[model samples]
Target: MNRKIIITGTTCTGKTTLGKKLAKEFLIKQIDLDDIHFLSNWIEKENTAFVKDVNSEIEKHLEWIVTGSYQTLLKDTVWQEGTLIVWLDYPLNLILRRYFIRTYRRVFLKERCCGENYETLKSTFSSESLFLWIFKTYWHRKRRMHHWKNTLFSHKEWLILKHPKEEQKLRNLLYDN
Candidate 1:
């Protein structure tokens, strides 16, 4: 079967970057879960609608690499259909630094995702902030992956990439294999 990859990790762990890369390498479409979940002004879509849309996308795409860490609504669908789950487990310091830098860049440049733009420093530091979310969920995500790595899903192929070198190695392996 052709692989359907799900790239998931804590916020700012380069899932999007690596997903895009893998998609390009394999010539598959890349789906950003953020694009489906966020609406104008950074508001989250309703859970029911969000799940429906995600399910629709998963069904519509023949082969894809979807990237996100939104487990509350979309995890079950992704885990069920994804042939390989690539977990980007980077250090907290690295994630924190990337979170701040990416947030600053997006805010300063007025870059928008899912029709939302960063409008204020307070918005960037609040409970809703990706930075804080990453810090809050880092260990919990790690633990969940640890548990997941031993389940039926564990028997499926999983690549836990921790560093740039390992990521490159996995990329090479994916292409070679």
Candidate 2:
């Protein structure tokens, strides 16, 4: 398809899932920022290094579905170059519900994260929990994406997917190739 796609949104919005599906269907590479951003024990790669590596990796591929919300880290470079920017604007309640279920499974089932970090029951219920983080950032992220789409990425192509119930609609929009 010769597409350079960026699938982004707040947590549990299916950005990574859609990216993987598209990449597999198209036989193109898929890049998840989480994979490049974190290390063992959930430690972060240095900001400079992470940005460099991500940009370098993106530059090497002609077709890819890049998923993540690290827009500031990328300096708008990827957004400016993307063929399509998919923003999954799901409801907060839905996101929270999904996050809770995912985290619960991770804690009890020993599901490993992108960095090979496992969630602990203690951590899952803590103030530092990803659930809390997502709760706090959901609205902010939606606002920011809106602003960027109109401002920083005004000229780029965009696909704003909202509400998961619109399954056939989403498929139709995405399969427009």
Candidate 3:
């Protein structure tokens, strides 16, 4: 397809996995916002810098699968330009469970994303735990995505993949092309 796709969802909804798969199938670049927005020691980049970097990256490619929920920095730009937006609207329990498990594994294994390692339990539990962020923002994110679907992004090919089966079906459909 010629569309510039964006796969977005709350934390732990498999946006990265699906984005990677779709990008590979389409031979388009995949831009994981986390990698660009986060710095070493798990610190976030400044808003201005993040926006500039994201816009620069977006400019470098004709087609891309941009994945993340960086609403403050990139939402308008991404939505305005994206041809397709895929929202993974999974159930809350599923997302929370996945978030917990993924955080647990990453913490235990000391997994790093883009060279930024997570902090200790004290730091994580205090104010930086992704799990906590998930719990805090899940409903808000759901509502926002729903509203966007009905309003700003209505004309876009907005696909709501709510389950693994549906995700797989879409994957197969896209891959077959």
Candidate 4:
């Protein structure tokens, strides 16, 4: 398809899963920004360096699916070049539930996430916890995406999948092509 796709949303919105599935189906490269933005030691990459590296990597591929909410890092490059922007606008409660489950698995089961970061009770309960982060940013993210949908990215091809049925329809449509 040679499509440059971006799947973005707040934490725990299934961006990575959808990106992986689409990339696999289309035989294109897939990148999760978190994987390249955070180091193994959990230190974040410098903003300039992160932007440069991500831009370089994406520029190397003609077709790619990049999943993450890094508008600051990618706006001029990947985001601008995207053929389709998939915004997952799930409900706040659903996002909270998903985040809780994901964090629980990571913290209790010691599951590794992007950047090789693992969740711990101490960390999960701390201000840095994904759960707390989601609570703080979910509404803000939704508002931002809504703004983009109406103004900034209005002319671009976009999909706002708010429910499982819509997501399934999107999947079917993509797979059909």
Candidate 5:
């Protein structure tokens, strides 16, 4: 198959982790939309610029694994090109556990991300924090993904893994020959 794999989830659902592993196993480029979508200091890239850059990067590689979804902005480009779409719709409790661990490292440990943006405590608990965003969008994103999967994306090949216990199954699905 001509592999144009896309790993998508709301937040902290191991999208990037899975994308990286798949990219390495397939020896294909890993395109992270988050890397392209953020400017320095957590600022978002302009929509036009983000779309242009994402399209350019995707166009550069015929075989690639992509992480993150900006479906509203990129439905015509990346999502359209995906041959295998992996949706990690893990439970909210699992999502929050991952979030706390990640945020602890990023905020307290001062880990840099998204082109030099560091998460501060102020940002961690604030309205704009990823923590808050996760809570706000978890159910919404889940509904959206299911809606898209059953409707707009019904024709596509989808692998929806709903829990961490499905790890072995996931590996077998993607890794076994």
Candidate 6:
């Protein structure tokens, strides 16, 4: 399938994983919004520069999968031109479990992530902790995503996977295609 796809979901709902899998299956470029929005040392790129950089990178590709939860990034022309919007609507418990596991792996394994940043124990417990941020914003993010799905993207084609089984089916289908 030659398509421009965007995968979005709450923290740890596997946006990046799905994006990577789709990219590999389709033999298309994959872009992670976090990589453009966050720099080394966890510094955030300026809004204009971030948008410009993301737009420039995406414009160069005919078919690609981009993943992230940034709504601002969704406003870009690339998103408007996207052929598919995937919403991973797993349950809160599932999302939290994944979040904790991913965080543990990142902190313990010192896994490098967006912009080559590592998740240190100190940072994970600090005011900037992704865990903490998720706790504070989970509901809000869910609501926002729902609103976007019902409104902003109501006209777009979407695959709203709400369970692990559905995700597996999607993977299998993508592989077959």
RMSD of each: 1.7, 1.7, 2.0, 1.6, 1.6, 2.0
lDDT of 6 by residue, 137-168 (tens): 77887797778778987888777899866877
Residue-level lDDT for 2 in candidate 2 = 68
- Candidate 3 per-residue lDDT, tens place, 61-139, comes to 9888888888646767877888878888899888878877776767687766543656466665777677778889899
Off by over 4 Å in 3: 172-177
lDDT of 4 at 133: 84
> What TM-score, to 2 decimals, does candidate 1 have?
0.91
Model 2 steric clash total: 0
Which scores higher on lDDT, 2 or 5?
A: 5
Query: What are the clashing pairs of model 4?
Result: none
Per-residue accuracy of model 5 over 1-177 as CA lDDT, tens digit each:
667888889889988877887778768899888889988878899999999999999899878888997877988888888888888988889999999998899888887766567889988878798878888888888888899899988899888888867756656766653
Candidate 5 shows a clash count of: 0
Ranking by lDDT: 5, 4, 2, 6, 1, 3
lDDT of 5: 0.84
TM-score of each model, in listed order: 0.91, 0.92, 0.89, 0.92, 0.92, 0.90
Runs of candidate 6 exceeding 4 Å displacement: 169-177
Candidate 4 local lDDT, 1-177, one digit each (tens):
567888999899889878887778778899999999998867899999999889889989998889999875677777788888888888888888888888888888888878798767898778787877887888888888788778878888888899645777667656765
Order by TM-score, highest first: 5, 4, 2, 1, 6, 3
List, residue by residue over 5-54, the lDDT tens digit for candidate 1. 88888888888888888888888888888888888777888989988888
- Total clashing residue pairs per candidate? 0, 0, 0, 0, 0, 0
Q: Where in model 1 is the C-alpha error above 4 Å?
A: none
- The alpha-carbon root-mean-square deviation between model 2 and the true structure, to one decimal in Å, is 1.7
Candidate 4 lDDT score at position 102: 86
